[model samples]
Target: MPSRFTDEREITGVADLTPVQRDQLRAAGKLYDGEDLDAAARLVDDPDDERSFLGFCNLWRVVDGSEDRYDAWLYQVDSGTIFRAGTTDVAAEIIQFGLETRDPAVRAELGPALVEAGLLPKSDVSYPEFAGLLRTQQGA
Candidate 1:
């Protein structure tokens, strides 16, 4: 199965967009917002490249599209927590640790998962909790 992170994505920035390109992006963004990755890919120039594709995925997460889990991942990445929960079973334990131990490290590790899962708030969660959660989950 294709993981959320595609290997060939790129990022040329917004200035690189054209009117038609903008339209395609808008369409793709909308499709992504609607939880339709296939449809979004159709609006993009290269589905295999990282730029437009990563942008689409980022947009999807920003809009809290498709699954909340993806949003959680984005949020955590934005906050400098590079870790991802791997899969649902892995993610569940991470989240539970955050609820149980209030460990910042664990939370830091799991923060991305929360962002992907769309569970985090606008305010950045504490780093200690994230770290602890991550450690706990890792130990498990």
Candidate 2:
């Protein structure tokens, strides 16, 4: 079947994934309009089958063309679901909530794991101190 990720090579695909799964793929630039969702689903499920999750969730500042990418990646994604999804990545999607969101409440709620994961510096994990450039600059 044709690939949904790009105008590229063909591969066998899996179907019957959830709407959110499809949304995640779409947000990450894995699937496009009138493309193959099944093939896109295959990329996330198969860890050893040579897959690359494209697109940057952090580019919500500059790239405005992709509403799905912007909304789903930067805001709608949940970090707890990352491990449950096996290989699919929501880390890029949800980092803003934990480390860079302007809401101190959100950072307080989600920043701990980011800090423990080494995504945040030890110094920045403190309340007055902040983790990312966006976090410090925009959040403050």
Candidate 1: segments with Cα more than 4 A from true spot: 1-10, 13-125
So what's the TM-score on candidate 2? 0.31
Task: Show the colliding residue pairs in model 2.
Answer: none
Candidate 2 on 1-140: residue-level lDDT in tens? Answer: 11011111122232543565555555444322234344364345444533323221211111112312111222123221121132344433243333445555444433443442344445443533434433543344
Error of 1 at 101 (Å): 19
| Count of backbone collisions within predicted model 1 | 42
Model 1 worst lDDT window (10 residues):
72-81
True-structure lDDT of candidate 1: 0.34
lDDT of each: 0.34, 0.34
TM-score of each: 0.25, 0.31
Shift of residue 4 alpha carbon in model 2, Å: 33
User: For model 1, how does the per-residue alpha-carbon lDDT over 1-140 read when each residue is reduced to its tens digit?
Assistant: 11122222233344544444344344433333443333234345665744234443232221112332321222112321122222212121223123222455443434543443444443544444544454564563
Model 2's number of clashes is 0
Alpha-carbon shift of residue 44 in model 2 (angstroms): 8.6
